[model samples]
Target: MPDAPPSAAPVEESTEDWRRRNVGRLLNEAVRRFESRVLERLAEQGFHGVRLAHVGVTRNLDVAGTRPTELAYRASMTKQAMGELIGQCVDLGLVRREPDPADGRAKIVRFTDQGLHFLEHFRRAVVAAQGEMGENLGEERVRALLETLWDYVHPDGT
Candidate 1:
């Protein structure tokens, strides 16, 4: 009979250390890496200065123009932050601020033609990046992984 391979030594870790480094922490790190990879891919596809967060505004604008307050609520960002980002977008000619019909004092943010074009490009980039990732993980595993992750994030439908 062949001899069994030498047994590996058990590495001991403290309960506090293990708890301190749990799945939530690991998942957060993984998400950062995943977003970085996706954003890098997006830049290669002509979205030079865009990041993942831009998706929220672009999509929201595509659906319908919204006030800064509404966008902040939807995106879970501060109104000031949304305003600043909208200002930067306006400077880039991606979006515009137009007078709100209901409230003359309020301006709604709308996506420009260029912004729509960029949104389409962003969708394609995301698809391409996800395709690459799915290829690495395989379709079946990717589907299962997505389902598991979704379940973890939201017990019911989200």
Candidate 2:
């Protein structure tokens, strides 16, 4: 006679359990949705040629300009990858490489006039996105969520 298989136990899915299981996935989906919305808004505002991959570099760009190495580190990408993105941005007239005043041998990436215009659109889109998120999540929950994300990103409070 064949042995009977053990019966599986029923598991109750509580809210906390569900959240624990899905938070990371939800976070990634939220980011993708937010980025898509922002890009859509930018396109409506007349910005073009900006891809999702470019955000990895642009989001970490320094307002005063920064060295490629520093930007790469900030973006957690290799220098070669950053260089390629910078080259693309340069070709798009979004950025330019200028000789670093502090180091003659080095170059710093600075935004072109067009890039600054694009940045303005990006800023407005982000603000609109945040407002939408607040409306959907409620102000208090959005605030708490921002605080939690900040703490998670800066665990040492630096």
Candidate 3:
């Protein structure tokens, strides 16, 4: 039989901690859990087919339609990566690609009629999830958390 791995020994210094958890990791985990809760609420409301991966497209998307480059910038992903997600959205009947009016060479990503409906569901899902979080963590705490994160994200409040 294979031997088990050695057990982790607690380190005296936090920097020497084996777990290696940190601020960025905590923030990433919180965002993921929040989105997962949103997805659960969406599914409970009879909305399906939407998945976490779609957030990269849907969350950054402008209602008036936006170019993939702008979406990538907003989502903090590569243009090519967002393009692949956009393709997935197209296949899922969530969005369509159209030639940009002013920029003939670029394409704009717009939601399909179905996608608009999905957007409503997405909005409701997020609110419901946030409500649950507020219930669990107290409304004041939730509000503070949102404000804190927003401040950190946009230090200049532009």
Number of the top lDDT candidate: 3
* Highest-TM-score candidate: 3
Poorest 10 consecutive residues of model 3 by lDDT? 3-12
Candidate 3 shows a clash count of 0
Ranking by lDDT: 3, 2, 1
lDDT of each: 0.75, 0.83, 0.85
Residue 136 displacement (Å), model 1: 1.7
Candidate 1 lDDT over 42-140, as tens digits, reads 678777877666766776664478888888888889989888888888876779999999999999998888888887777776677677768897988
What's the CA error at residue 76 for candidate 1, in Å? 1.7
Provide the clashing-pair count of each candidate structure.
0, 0, 0
Q: Tell me which residue pairs clash in candidate 1.
A: none
- Tens-place lDDT per residue, model 3, 2-21, is 53333445435645343444
lDDT score for candidate 1 against the true structure = 0.75
What candidate 3 gets wrong by more than 4 Å, as runs, is 1-21
Model 1 lDDT-worst window of ten: 3-12
1 against 2, candidate with superior lDDT: 2
Question: Which scores better on TM-score, 2 or 3?
Answer: 3
User: How far is 77's C-alpha from truth in model 2 (Å)?
Assistant: 0.8
TM-score of each: 0.77, 0.83, 0.84
